[model samples]
Target: MDFSENFLHYVWRFRSFDSAELKTAASENLKIIHQGFLNANAGPDFSNAKIQLDGTIWVGNVEIHIKSSDWLKHHHQIDDAYNSVVLHVVYENDVPIKRKDGTTLPVLELKNRISTELITRYERLFLTLTDFPCINQIREVDQLVVDAVLSRTLVERFEQKTGAVIEMLNNLNGNWDETFYRFLARNFGFKVNAFPFEAFAKAVPQQIYAKHKDNPLLIEALVFGASGFLNDEFTEAYPKQLKAEFQFLQKKYNIKPIDATMWKFMRMRPQNFPTLRLAQFAALIIKANHLFSKIMAITDVSKLRMLFEGLPVNDYWKTHYHFKKQAAAVSIQFGKTSINNVLLNTVALFLFAYGKHTATQSYINSAIKLLETLPAEQNAIIERFTGAGVKIDNAFGSQGVLQLKKQYCDEKKCLSCGVGVKILRSSSNHH
Candidate 1:
């Protein structure tokens, strides 16, 4: 009675409870020929079931509840949806259920039929307080099972991440280049400023970038100016020039700037400051015109990495983290890790998404291979999975683990996971 209805559903689906002498509450012999498909919607628990009640065959829906009295409690007897229910399955037969026409409905009680050991296994996995429901016993699961789950989760992660890409593509009227530009700009914000960066990209059209692609200063002016950073008065000559150039471009192109307050500076590395990132982004745009086309042509992972290397930004950015806020001159190279993060989050995602859209296997393979070639990402989620003895060698493994952790482990979908299924099925005694 303390257990969930899902446990009863699982027991019935697997026939884990005693079925040797199944009988209806009215003393008629009952035999389950087919235990209908489990329904997830707002209807019967199972549909299209087949049963033989006292040598008479019946085919219809089957409903499950914790108690027979719940039939009246939930008002299912009066609901037209329950009219087709051929059988009622409950954990406890507290009272007899009647159909709308007032005939007593056949009931199958599972309280006494299910084994205690199966209950213990379910409780161990679903009721525990561990970080992951099966963390304590995950290592004991077979290697093949673990690998299968990870592989499944990897593709699931790809599909899940690319869903947004596909939606954006639809909005862009199937323009792969423009969609790629917007998504890449969003990733350039990394995490903190992704939204504003995306908004900034959307505010200015790609044609304007193409018009001024040859002029790096104009590009930087457009980037910083449109980002609302050029509005402030600057002591430095470069920002002053950027402000003047942006004013010219803003009026000529009818471009609007996002609010400067949208950018965050507190508790962030100066190297990752939005100003530097904007400068790097402008350099990237100038360096790679028709970048999506170039990316599609490159099959090698290193060649893809070369595309983001050595972006040429103005020397002012090398000493300044903000407008007129000059720090000790630092080499303002976009670090390898940052480049790889772009490749992983942006390049690989586009490859996978474009492949899915165009029905090209090569692009899909390239996307997956890129992840496999990249070094493993360092994060708390990866650390926890590695701590649990999960063998993650590269970004592919780490990403898969991240998806598995968030989707299955965090949601406590133990009964639905392959690893959790294996663990629960290991119980030797079944009714």
Candidate 2:
């Protein structure tokens, strides 16, 4: 009766009104001329439902409602959708309903006819925990349908990403530059460690860059800005070396440094903490002064990856972004896949966040390229779960599966899921 409650699935599987030989409780023989797409809301909710009572043929649509009173509750009396409605199908038929001309609507009570197995399955799906709500159904449905389902999941995945982007836009107030930077920082940490990275970004005041624009001082600032090393008391030589450099920059650019705890390195792999992230960020900034400008017009994945090839970190970055007890050489690299992932995240964030403002899907191609090249058990698992169709596409596509697994299938909320509606109805009548 509540057509909004996985109603489309029920209609598709049950063929609820398809058998014209059937009759409603009123003894009117039923004949369905058309049943619109499962999710149809526009035009007519339910298409032709021709029936005959006492040998007089009637031809019109069937209007579905959760409760008989919902007819009046939805203002359907004045609604044109109700105008073509010849019969009201409801789970409960306590109240009477009428059309504009005051002919009482014939009622079809479906509660008893509805499969208990389907209802029970839904109840159980919501009650239990599982990896996939209808994952079990995967082997049964046609491969093509499953493929289509994943494709729909893909768009749905992007839809969610777009929603998040909209939220970010509201927070950033449409400033693309600041939005990209903040989003980048947040994304660098990934979902597991995003807040920590954000705190690191907020702590590294940009004044460090303003104060030491000269190459050496700038490099030192970049390193110290992230190391959690800047907060320590400086010796005479420390101030002398840095201050001596600062004096030269002072004439050209007013230099003042703010103290922030150098990023924590204890117990962390030297490459995994704020020190490395800042170096990466700085290398990126130094290599591309107007980085985003170069690619604002680019949506193609392959071309985007090409654009990023071998852009160097600042020269000083070769020797140090962090001066640990022992120093090393300049051979560090961000995995191609890693960079691709980052770009995919940014691209997806922009595309989805921009909403109707941007329509091109080159970002999708770009993501696909990045994901296709990445190596990981998790990535492989996702690619496998989605099946070997187009392969892992991007941060949006990869994270989308994680989102679904976390949000829907994990909780077994099948009654609320599209696939659940299809499967539960069969399982209800299943012996």
Q: What lDDT would candidate 2 get against the real structure?
A: 0.55
Segments in model 1 whose C-alpha atoms lie over 4 Å from true places: 232-237, 358-362, 428-431
Q: How close is candidate 2 to the true structure, as a TM-score?
A: 0.67
Relative to the true structure, candidate 1 reaches a TM of 0.89
What tens digits encode model 1's per-residue C-alpha lDDT throughout 1-431? 35788878877887778898889899899999999999989988999999999999999999999999999999998899998999999999999889998888999988888878888888888888775888778888887788788878988999998899989888999888999999899999999989989999998867788998889999999999999998888887888898989999999999989998999888998888888899999899899877898999998877999999999878887788889787888768889999989999999999999898889989999999999999889999888777777778888888888888899999887776788778867773455
Each candidate's TM vs. the true structure?
0.89, 0.67
TM-score leader:
1
Off by over 4 Å in 2: 1-9, 12-20, 36-85, 90-104, 111-128, 166-174, 191-193, 196-229, 233-267, 297-300, 306-324, 327-331, 351-356, 361-397, 410-431
- What would the per-residue lDDT of candidate 2 be over residues 1-431, giving only the tens digit for each residue? 22343443364336632343557666776654444333356634566556565566677776776677878887888876667776677777778887888988887766665555555555555544556655545455554544444455656666777676667657866655555555666666655546656665454444445344445446455444343344444553443354444445444544333333423456655445555565566555555434444556665545666554565544444555454333566445555655756766675446444534465555455444544443422554476556634234444345645655655577654544545655555564442
- Identify the candidate with maximal lDDT: 1
For each candidate, the alpha-carbon lDDT, in order, equals 0.88, 0.55
Which whole-number lDDT from 0 to 100 does residue 17 have in model 2? 26
By summed lDDT, the worst window of 10 consecutive residues in model 1 runs over 422-431
